[model samples]
Target: MRIDTRVEINAPASLVREKLLAFSEHADWNPFFTSIELVGCDIRDSDSQVKPGDRLKVSMKDVRSGKVSTFTPTVLSCTAKKFEWRGSLIGQWFFSGIHTFEFLEKDDSQKCVLLHHETFSGIAIPLLRPLLKGTQTNFEAMNNALIEVCENGC
Candidate 1:
């Protein structure tokens, strides 16, 4: 199953990417992933730049239920255009999710579109399908908050 959400931000892709990659500032604008921490990395003095293979311990809050869940995901990619990570429960066959954030420039304009999505697969997916609708709504809220942060110079 996949949950996708997008939002157009009135800011340059560079600015959008910058704020999105700024894990340290997530608490200021992000309502979903309320906390993010780089695991076992000594670069915590400043806003650490996430790179492929980096491990992240993140706390995500469900917008509707207000339930918080923590997970350690391995970063798959972190570039100017995209950021992706994979998190799993037990093993991939049991439960896994690939979360991604893509930044698309709008025809050479300052504006950009942010695509936030998560693809879930595993034997548990069928059982978890009922909660996906709320997850999508949470993604939308996060995208809107990203727009506000990126456009307002976060």
Candidate 2:
């Protein structure tokens, strides 16, 4: 199973990426990621940032359950145009997901489009995943928040 969502923001890709990589400020505009702490760095530091191969402890709340889940995920890739990461549930056979993001420069040159997508695969995906709710809403909410923040000079 897969759930993908994306949005376009009227801002430069550099600014967008800068905001996205700002782990310390995630909770300011992102609800999905309540908090993210780098493995060996102070999350509250003003200069803290995430890079490829870094490990992160993330706390995310399940909208419906209202319960926060914590996990340590490795940074699969990070670059000016794209970013990716993978996480698992229990083990690979049970449930796993890959989140990918693309920051494309629009034809206008001054605007950018963000393509955020996630793929889920595992033997238990069909059985353990939520059926009543989907991740699309959360993704859109985050996108809107990001757009507002970036456009407002965050």
Best by lDDT: 1
Candidate 1 wrongly placed segments (more than 4 Å): 44-48
Q: Give TM-scores for every candidate, taking all chains together and pairing residue i with residue i.
A: 0.93, 0.86
What TM-score would candidate 1 get against the native? 0.93
Model 1 residue 87 lDDT?
Answer: 97
Residue 31 of model 1 has an lDDT of 93
**Tens-place lDDT digits, model 2, residues 1-154:** 7777778899998888888878788887777778876787545444224677777788876655667778887778887888787888888778888888789999665888999888888888768677415577766777888899899954
Residue 46 error for model 2, in Å? 7.4
- How far in Å is the alpha carbon of 18 misplaced in model 1? 0.9
Give the range where candidate 2 is weakest over 10 consecutive residues by summed lDDT: 41-50
Q: What TM-score does prediction 2 earn?
A: 0.86
Give the clashing pairs for model 2.
none
Q: What value does the lDDT take at residue 89 in candidate 1?
A: 92
RMSD to native, candidate 1? 1.6
Model 2, which residues run further than 4 Å from truth?
41-49
Mind giving the per-residue lDDT tens digits that candidate 1 earns over 1-154?
8888888898888888888777888888899999888898767554437788989999999998999999999999988899999999999999999999888899686899888899999999988788666988888888888888877754
